[model samples]
Target: MKNNILFKQQLFLVLTAIFFTSCLSNVDEEVIIEEPVSEITFNVHVKPIIDNNCTQCHSTAGGTSPNLETYAGVSANAARIKAEVESKRMPIGGTLTDEEIQAISIWVDAGSLNN
Candidate 1:
């Protein structure tokens, strides 16, 4: 009876260890890597930033600031935009991420293409 109890205890310990270890084993982990935007387009990339940050004050109708309402308007002011955003000057009420500033710089450097 003692031998049987010892065997059962050893089996229980081994089974518990196996169960816990199996539970702790690594399942497949999904790591998503986002590739940086190599080509930034005005309509796709710049428009959102301008719409979110500038349009409230600089829309075509308000006219207090330059109209950032269209591609022509934004392209014309791309250099200024880059400068202001780089210096954290333009968003007046808020701020942009470094990545956002870098994207604008990259877009401006790439000729502020309308793509």
Candidate 2:
């Protein structure tokens, strides 16, 4: 009788471990489906981020700034823009969404085209 109880307990523990392992195996990993970098453009995508976020202090109107309000200005400093945004250093008093930062990064990676 004692051996039977011990055997049942060990069986229960083994079954419980198997059940939990199966449950863990069924859990799906989260996959983010962001827009392709090729789909990101300067005029439509990057401009909006720079206009709404960066222009606050990186424009001609902002004084002593890099003039991030225009295509030439943004393209000229595309690498720096990506670096600053990735580091969360720009936009000064405000914040940018992950989507916005990804857009800027994609634009720069796509060669900072005028489009």
Clashes of each: 0, 0
TM-score of each: 0.65, 0.71
Error of 1 at 93 (Å): 1.0
TM-score of 2: 0.71
lDDT of 2 by residue, 34-63 (tens): 798778989888898888888878877777
Off by over 4 Å in 1: 1-38
Specify the highest-TM-score model's number.
2
Error of 1 at 64 (Å): 1.9
Top candidate on lDDT is: 2
Clashes of 1: 0
The superposed Cα distance between candidate 1 and the true structure at residue 62, in angstroms, equals 3.1
lDDT of each: 0.84, 0.87
